[model samples]
Target: MRKLASICLVFLIYFACSVMSAEDRTIYQFTVKDSDGADVSLEKYRGKVVLIVNVASACGLTDSNYKQLKELLDTYHERGLEIAAFPCNQFGGQEPGCDADIKNFIADKYKFDPDLYSKINVNGADAAPLYQFLKKEQGGTLIDAIKWNFTKFLVNREGRVVERFAPTTAPKDIVKYIEKLL
Candidate 1:
């Protein structure tokens, strides 16, 4: 029937363009908002090895992850390493604070000085475009959706995503990959 044909066509179009193709796409192509709501382009990190992670303030892994991440930064930040931590509240509502509060918590608890980004959804229909691209490029064990907070995506100096780490994988565990990229 004509109505059935129209529905199928609409479905096909939507499926094809849900997200941009992961191939030939670099993280530098996107612009994201920092904690202060200022637009920051990933392009500035073009020649640096970058670790992008979704963080939650109240998660069980918060302490270890932030400590290890800060360590990694202190060790390799001068050697061309950059960490982009995105505060996400999708997992169990862990990061239930405003940008200022999140910034204050990290600074006071862990002495983390890097720029904190605005809270973002790492999964579901409202996922950020950068996240959508990262998930498509390096899919998970059973699904492309992000499993939980602290999911890390490592990008090479060329701005392409090279590795995807789970929420459970500590930042210290991937120093070799970062060193290699650097």
Candidate 2:
């Protein structure tokens, strides 16, 4: 009877700890597709500040955002600021093009060297699981559905969602947040 009590106590402790962990968790399990179509796990960036953006090639802010995004990558990449861009078209078919074309435009126009991936849905029922997780993790003051292209999510070094930036928010405006994370 003593041995049975000990086993039950151990199981209860373990279960309680598991429940606590789930409640206190940040986002460290999401996997997104890299520019090469390979699974890029967020675990690899556990100790880095991540800036995730839903991009659109033909959008009005595309060029400016790409330019500033390039600057951000060049400046803070070594300092652990990771910029992940996901081409999206859900806003207004602004990103209606193949991956290669999107890549070429970014390379030729803005000289952006950050990781760019295939077009993905940023809103609606078809949104990627990663986006779904992001929206849930850091919904804005107004709504969860991304308002437009270039919507950005800032994740701290500990994989905790820190803030959300609208498409109109300049990439330079995010420098302060990056510094805060650092």
TM agreement with the true structure for every prediction = 0.87, 0.84
What are the per-residue Cα lDDT tens digits for candidate 1 across 7-31? 9999999987666575558988899
lDDT per model vs. reference? 0.91, 0.85
* Residue 42 lDDT (model 2): 75
Off by over 4 Å in 1: 1-23
Candidate 2 Cα outliers beyond 4 Å, as residue runs = 1-24
Report the error of model 2 at residue 49, Å: 0.8
lDDT of 1: 0.91
Instruction: Tell me which residue pairs clash in candidate 1.
Output: none
User: What root-mean-square deviation over C-alphas does model 1 reach?
Assistant: 4.6
